[model samples]
Target: MAKKNSNDNGKTFTTQQGLNSYIKGICDIMRRSNCAGALQYVPELSWLLFLKILDDTEQREAEEAEAVGDSFADSIPEPYRWRDWANPQGNRRLNLQMGQMGQFLPFVNEEVIPYLKSLKNKPQATPRQKIISEVISSVERVRIDTETNLLDILDKIHEIDYIDPTHIFPISQVYEGLLLKMGEKNNDGGQFFTPREVIRAMVKAITPQVGETIYDPCCGTGGFLAQSYEYIRDFLADDITPEQLKTIKLKTFYGREKENLIYPIALANLVLHGIDYPHLWHGNTLNREVIYGDLFQDAPPQFDIILTNPPFGGKEHRTVQAQFAYKTSATQVLFLQHVIDSLKPGGRCGIVLDEGVLFRTNENAFVQSKRKLLNDCNLWCIVSLPAGTFVAAGGGVKANILFFTKGKPTEKIWYYDLSDVKVTKRKPLMMNHFQEFLELLPNREDSERSWTVTREEIEAKNFDLKAVNLNTKVDEDKSTAKELLDFIEEKGKEVALTLSVLRKWER
Candidate 1:
């Protein structure tokens, strides 16, 4: 029997009762002959969870609309109504398994497509239908319904408050766990599991507002985009009038990606957070596609606020057809250029970057190009996170967050140092450094935690964007005394106990 717990508000936990089982299921399904790492597998789960939640929401909304004599069901449009997509005409996957169909058709012409097209309002349906059909079937087979028998298993998920945009991580933790497990299976999979606290701190510093266009070129597990929306929701929820609320609700929101599996999850994450379906689009930000159109051939939309932690530390090199405004490798440099190109004249951006991009002199011209870009962009802030901050997932690599605004030469930039420290945590991956860091951010001149450096200072080092220049506090004396005394006390106690045991044995 499934374990059940009731909330104070009368909501009951059913589906996510056993957290371990859910984790095991995610691992088992992801390792199922994918010919890929956990990154690929967890995305499969992300997409599946998206569809089931949408179906469950549609079913509930339809019933509610009928009872209230409201046409919300007609107006709202069902983005993932299962029967509409899976049970459509001549589109049956009789003997075929999910992998075959997903590889073939993707998101187009599924049951959900028809329901969306039939919506009384919203033109996003027809274009949405044209997207590949595989995304739908891939999501369909992984459905957490009667077949998987994980319904009661996911009930505990409701307790998580994913719907409350303020509670971003609970929802994010659901995916983070899957990504971490995926990372364990494959060396490259760890990139997706950005700690929620780290993500929250990044979003806080970026200060995303209502109605801003947001983008993540490498949107692993959709953490940044989802958290950005929640940040905006919370921002607007404070000290705003009813009319302001309406405007904020209808404001344009967006996300772009090349990952086919992550695309659906990104959309679902946004929709669940209250953004309309039309806001999210799927396409390679780097490559031209029939659906997303050619970003290279045509000018991409200018985003007002960009928040992302781009994919990092991989050996694969990507080719570029044309010379870029910036110079660097495919993953980091390409994304940096993409984010720069995607921003409006006055946009702001925050991104997670590996230290290699900061101090590499091999690409001198590339380094010069980045300096020019940073100066032209008015780079604002850099926060260096500690090493053990992400130690559990391997890749003890150091990382930092870069914040900048578009279209102005930067005179000076503020840097905060929190690296090389241990955050108080009962478990691994729960870092509280962000909270401590944010407390000192408002001043921007805390001698112990932050420092402001001029462009000349940065240029002196040949434009390395690292954060080590910031002021820091270290306690070496305290560490020495604690280590020595703790060792002596432990050894002394052991010797005394051994002597007592020997005396007893002799008697």
Candidate 2:
């Protein structure tokens, strides 16, 4: 638990360490319960954290309304409210804890969850109520195995003060850390997450402004959209108006997510990041299928800027492929086509593409897609990411970041290579690694690591946009045959000695 210190005003504040410890304690209890994996625990935790924060926000709003002698309405009603049932100090929670042994669990499963899920179906549900409904839409019951564990988790979560200033950092950042666990190796969450450093670099290059709409067609847990919000908020901190702030918070960010599990997570994530309204569509982006689109109803047909890392190495059905201009089973390629068509004429995009999408010319779909990209957009820059860059996400494919603006054909392309820098799971990619790349990006400056390619050259090579470094020379091995044989013999002796020891141990 975080050690709480009382401020001069008598309000308690906790340090970042305290907040981290609290989250860790909650995860420990979750592991002991039913949600042992990131996939299981993250979704379960997202809803709980969301409700806790929402209740805090509403409580503050209600107090302000009372001070002004105005009416206040809560989106959640009665025992369904976190204060009513989840808060440790609340009378309802005290009664439940003091009642029949397992009563608390049944109330949550039968009454609370059902009432929350039914909010969207109400005759005149508010937008906030609808958002709440969609957030917990897939949650049939509490995932925590026992009442004791659930109650303990709630108590720890309650300690997190969302409205207080003492924490220094946004509580949303703590949630981002939890999302990172989902992207860790063997978690099966890489499909929904892009590395934060990569997202930061992309969002920086795109530099989305306050008035322009930003989008991600396949926004996993809403990382791109959330980071864009942070970037814009910080960038406009000095001169931004209240109306512009409102625009940025309520009307700027938009996205589409397909997974039943991930869609709600994306909503909760953006809300935590302070986006008052995240216009995210719940559906398959490629096929234009709508699972639920109430939040995205107000989104523009074309956005001013887009930043996304679409899923890699995914195969789509032909029926889905039939929707795109250049038909391909590869999900990335189809997404490229969709992004190109989805942008306004002068709109810009920053996208992460695997080497296959960049260099695979044999397939007509790949070649045609690249051709369309060059013809419709200014293919300005490509950053070749190092191998094992996505090893944490269980992906081993080499990848690159492509930045382009719609409405103009390609004249020349600037390429920056970070592939030479070795990336490993222990030493992951970071923002500082792109120092030289960003410095040179403004002018497309040439260096050993950076170079430019002309349109004519790309056409001659059938539009292979792979970042091939021309300045670096390959060092050829020139060991003598005798030396190689002696080295092999020494290794052979060591292997034989190890095997002999193993045989003796077996006996």
Candidate 3:
């Protein structure tokens, strides 16, 4: 049999029009059931929802064929061939067919089960299975359009098979990773997914060396590791010998967990992306067994590069044992210590942390740690991200990335004033501004948005890492109400003029 051309058949999956309708129907069903949360965690819901739509479409085709005496049902694909299985009359056959899809769903269910149970790391199957079953059946009730919409969504989703070994990856990769973003932000759900551009910028700056060990103690959806792998391979063209290729393509490059509900997603993501090394684990990094007291003993096999976006401001502190060799008030502080300790003396570390760690007055231990970072290590740079970068979760909390080396103090620390960069999905307010900062970054001296500062300057202000201390160049950049309103008015007129031009151009 000849392979089908999607454009010619106008039936094969991958068409954009098909995708939009499919996404619309899924979003609609999820919204109608008021179980959007299920879409967030319940893997069964995604699978059965997929099956229900597939089966419903298949049945419609079978009915149409039978009416016309064509009987083309037997020619359907493996997934779409669920007509005999969705039969309410043939329960045994239905169970047998669903069993195959059930295998994949079970794996996804494991990822979200931990969140539902409130048990970190451990699997809670019985109740999670019951919940998944109910959610799946409910989602299954939401009908997909048989005539046109079904073909569209299936084509879109099938473009990158979730299971194909040859393909690069899928949006399910984004979905699972977003949960980690949600967990990192401590949002209502997935409100703080690092913009893809932000992830790209972080990966570019970190410059993950191929075959070099890397870990994100708070590896949300393995974004740092995933992008790091791609960036290094793409830009550097690091050779992967046949043997290394096998290992690189199938091993875990970093570890990650999100209340256990997203671990499978993380693992699945890694597998889908051709990473098989730092096999992601399930457990809270701050918990006693994992992060507290001698993390070397807890988290074996130290890494070369530790890059992550750890959880933001929260009261998750506990009087942990000799877990940390250093001291700090917040868990973020403790994580910094753990990340430092996890590295070899020459290892590099990059992490996103709330601004408080940079300048907390009462935290003497944190202050001492900052001193240690300045005097004993290469405290290279600090880049302040815009406030709206994390607008959904840590909206108001200012954040900066602390990039440093583990060994000895390198002369001057660089500071980049990126506080003005607006973070949004559209044109002007995007995370891509970080790349401009990267381009302007100096090897040893100062450049735009990049300036060198020393411990003496930092100590002058009681050791504050905020942009106000080091880079006084932009001191006069504040906007008054009148200036802001005038700028807004000018922008409005520009938009109206542009719209008029567009209308004329279209005509």
Candidate 4:
């Protein structure tokens, strides 16, 4: 949203190139100062961008009101709105002169931020407005340690004035690019930022329709839902009626996330991608056996499509795990059960899971969960990714993208290995890497990197789906390193037992 003001240069820097250049420039400024890494940079940057968008949207709303002959009012009070305080040329600029550093720190840290925190946006404030206040209250100004850096960053933000229809899409990419940089810099952020390319691939594979309900239970940063909206929207744009579009915009994508920091980020991500008024909850998605009616009253019934990359290796509390049939602290195991129960009959899903879940003989829970997946759902495909895909975040364990549908037993499961392809942080995984896999997915065909095995065969292996890549020749000469290690450990135990007997005899 935007307003035509006196300084409206009418210069629409509406290209992704311009947005990228601006982001790069701002990031460089942050780095040159003490802002340092992306973790230190993005939180503050996100808030600043949010405030600017809010002020711009408010002005656009004001103009719309006047045009329709309705009286206009602002969500934010005067002297505190972005234009009043942040704009140097506006009626109420901050105490600091354009580039000066006088009382600017207190004005922001004491007055401005506090005012935002206290804002009610009130009695009849829209739910969207409530989200703004909630998100702002949770945000602590992170990298504004210096007056000059803060002022400079604010001024740079002021240059961008495109939150309206024509520019929002490409601009959304800028925000995603910033998050991508954060993920690359800090693997911890990876939990929030699944590679967009990977998400897009999953979305394409699932093929969510416009009227269908799509959900992500462990939705970190709302990546899956956002991309699903984009995919469904594009696929239906030509033939969609207004009512169908209304359904798409108002109630299509839904999500739930655990971390407060990431929850708001997920909401913001969805909104920036044009899914305004997102139905994403900021809480643990696994609180109850069934989520909607109990944990979230506003939530809908079993969704038609589910896509997610649940956090790998997270251990839920036993109390939380107690609700599952095959109870386990493992987050992936719990989420797998959650997804299975959450999907409607005929509902299809694409999810990411760690390698251990595929073959964990030590844990009966893991085996049971895999059995449930195959027995209760049609787990049609598994695309095994390279080990280094998530290695930066210490996720050295290989992973797979599982595509399945509810309401049928899995007769056959197809596996595609991308293990040979190196996917390090410096050289990250991309959509192109999945091209061959995608082409083969529809047919569920067998190839050099892909093959299928029956459920009976998998059952024979104790539900261990980590079958060797059929394409690779088996090594028959020497035992594998792990097997050799196991042998050594067993031999060492025997030697220790022998030593104890000899010592007892000597005594």
Candidate 5:
């Protein structure tokens, strides 16, 4: 019982499928425009959709308020609202008929954006107000010059039927899909996204409880935090109480991001998912002065659960490095220490780090970090991912998810090798793929990819957390490295092609 229709967008699709296809249609339009890549295209589309949704939400809120006789001040002014200008015929200032591009574009450019930009200057702006202002300031300019392209894209965006409750999840999927595409582009925007499947697996295995605080120190687009929320919400089923729901909404999830452009998207993403203006700080988590300084009420020093995929193998400035006692510029090492410090005594952590963190003795920083991790935490499991795990992020980096608990040192660490499966943009790793690992996790059962090594064995190995799949013969790294190189090379060619196709937008 699904609707079907042949349209210019593509083949016939059900409501959810059609909405998802509409998102791709917008991307196809952006691909032909001045937008250089998915990084540019995704954010532009996100803001437009966000505005439309905001407009719809406001209209509903206004109606409900009037029904209840409650006073409500609209977050956005009438002139800046989406309904005020997007429709040519309905717009009071645009006196134009349907199919006409009258003052819609101009109103967005001259009136709406300017109003958003000016809000930060107002005295005593709320956190939500500050976030809206931040979004407007960091988002890219509209690069689609042709009116036809602009209007066509609008047609696709307008297909998001906010009027129906059934459309909410599908519309959200449309937004998340666009973000995933941005991450897949492996450009600056790619930094905003972690592969969602990996995040879901981490959240599921860790299983955050209700009323417990969940946090992500380097929450790019809030993938881990959002997944954690979704995991708990579904797990509780109808058993979730009103007070518990309030706690989840107002206090459960917390995060911070350093990127200016990415931070706003993180806010928008979490807000869209029902956490009312989440407690995500827009600053470096490693910066003691910024993080420790009284900034946000939501920014806490410790957490019940920490889930994150921090940037890999990067160095901090010497000035920033001085903040940590470790006295090294290695970013991931510093983040590891921060996580350890940020967790409550019995708190759990699921973090992603490069393989070098486990075994690299060349630098004292890496060795020290591993030593600290082993000594202070019960390092339960390490899921060593496949080579192409992050191909969308431009390279094949061998990484692992470190699942641990504070207050107890690790006696025996469990390891799982998931490197056999090939993952790429076209073929992604799904949730079902993790079922095997999940089944074995609770009992610490031994299997081909799952095994246990005593802490004494780890200590003898100098805290080197490499491929510990002892039962089977480990393959050589040559093929994996070569495949990764080939993948990167192909990405480069795609970028070159994209440049050629979108060269006209460069001006």
Candidate 6:
């Protein structure tokens, strides 16, 4: 018989479905409590989940320390621990629940939240304590309206055991599902998340090693960094040394996020993904404003690999634009310049850029940025993604992935076009979509779907490096009027029959 986990309602669950259903139940409660959207609820859930995981991790550590007759000091002390306050069977929770009807919410808001938020201010705060403070920095108070709803959420969160091997998937993946909800259309979190498939392909192409520093200038929910960690861990497998593992977990990934709502979520997301120390600076990367740099202290001056999808189509202020060599209000153009300058000599980068950056020579900044990229890096490959690729994330812009290496001037550039391939919210761009591109990426081979453009040719067109597939045949519409009318009639009959059935069902 498999080990089972029981929720507060006495229902037992053991599989991913059970976990997902449990999470959905929590979300349903959150919805009724006014956290109706992912943007509203995910931030509230992130801190709760982070504390739960933190307490769980410390509990295991305490047990291990006892086994070795060593002392253990938890980063979160006393009543602030998740077990003390969040767990239903815990002494503090039982006391509060049994003593008064409405004490739990006040206690959490007044005592527990402030305590966690003040961890970094302590005279002798551990690194873990500092991390806990940073992760909950944006959380002012529990957003769930009623005490009952908040308690219910806590109960469900407590049931999630991160160390349980019986569960088929990692609990971290459950947090990823929450982040995915944030990225859904109209959630307004699409800006924080790139499609996971895109991040995976970029990480695979970059092939970041265990020791190589990987950074994301705009790491929304730390997806690129998390995926890179998984890639490196899987690449090394059993051959990985403890030192290398420590480096990967503690020092390998770094990022900067400006949004108050997103920075803490990024920390929690990366921590849930097993990054113990995600050296993320909470600040505006463009304007060089440092909101909090304690976690990012001692970070490398430059990185070995940068995988990012900088926010698309946002205009920066003059202060931000002034910081970049290429003065442009276009956010993506400034980010491109930052990525270029942040790369170490001979470093590689894989970045997602919109179509405007590729073909827009009207903007001097765009042309200058492209020129700098070509002059400073080996502009290896550009994969033109199809339209509606980001429809699930509510993005409608046509985008491309640019793969390049610094310390080498561009001679020629390979281009892989998937613009003809149709994608929608229902049908997203998958890893298999890049099958031919990945296979031909090594030698820069030319196929009907792939081509190359030389630097000289690009300069002739004033550096318009858009992937214009020369081999794609533009087929002429040769059907007669009668044929077209027949085709339309057939489709109209199908639609009429469907509507007629639907009308009968309505009755």
> Could you say which candidate leads in lDDT?
2
Cα lDDT tens digits for candidate 4, 276-329: 567766667787443112123466779899999887657677788788898877
lDDT of 2: 0.83
When superposed on Cα atoms, how far off is each prediction in RMSD?
Answer: 12.1, 8.0, 12.5, 7.7, 7.2, 7.9
For residues 155-206, what per-residue lDDT tens digits would candidate 3 score against the true structure?
A: 4333332222322433434344334334444432322244456667766777
Give stretches of model 3 more than 4 Å off: 1-24, 37-166, 170-192, 236-240, 256-258, 276-278, 290-300, 392-394, 424-431, 469-507
Give the TM-score of each candidate.
Answer: 0.68, 0.89, 0.65, 0.84, 0.84, 0.89
TM-score of 4: 0.84
Provide the lDDT at 12 for model 1.
26
Q: Give per-residue CA lDDT, model 2, range 1-507, as digits (tens).
A: 111221222223456666677687788899889998877898899999889888877887787788778878889987789887888866688888887899999999999999998898899987788889999999999999998899989887777766662242356777788888877834445578888898999898888988999999999999999999989878987788989989998889999999898899999998888887899899999889899898888888998998888886677888998888888778888999999998999999999987778877878888999999999999999999986677666555678999999998999999999987656666779999888888899999999899999999999999999999988766675869996786566445434533442343221
TM-score of 6: 0.89
Better candidate by TM-score, 4 or 6: 6
- Per-prediction backbone clash count: 27, 0, 17, 1, 1, 0
Point out where model 5 deviates above 4 Å. Answer: 1-14, 87-89, 93-104, 146-152, 187-190, 288-295, 473-507
* lDDT per residue (tens digit) for residues 1-507 in model 5: 111111233223357777677677788898888776877787777677777666666677677777777866667666676665553323543553343665455655666787876775668766556656666667545667676677777666655556543455566666777777777676444345778788889998899999899988888888888777778878896899988888887788888888776877877777666665577776787874342211256556789999988786466787877777675676778899999999999999999886667766666776777888888999999998875667665444567899999989889899988877767766767788799999999998999888998888877877787866667665666667788897777556644533442332122
Which 10 residues in a row give candidate 6 its minimum summed lDDT?
1-10
Supply the TM-score for candidate 5. 0.84
In angstroms, how far off is 336's CA in candidate 3?
0.6
The superposed Cα distance between candidate 2 and the true structure at residue 448, in angstroms, equals 1.5
- Residues 410-461 of candidate 1: C-alpha lDDT, one tens digit per residue: 9888888876554322334344656666777677765677788888988888
Rate residue 328 of model 5 by lDDT: 68
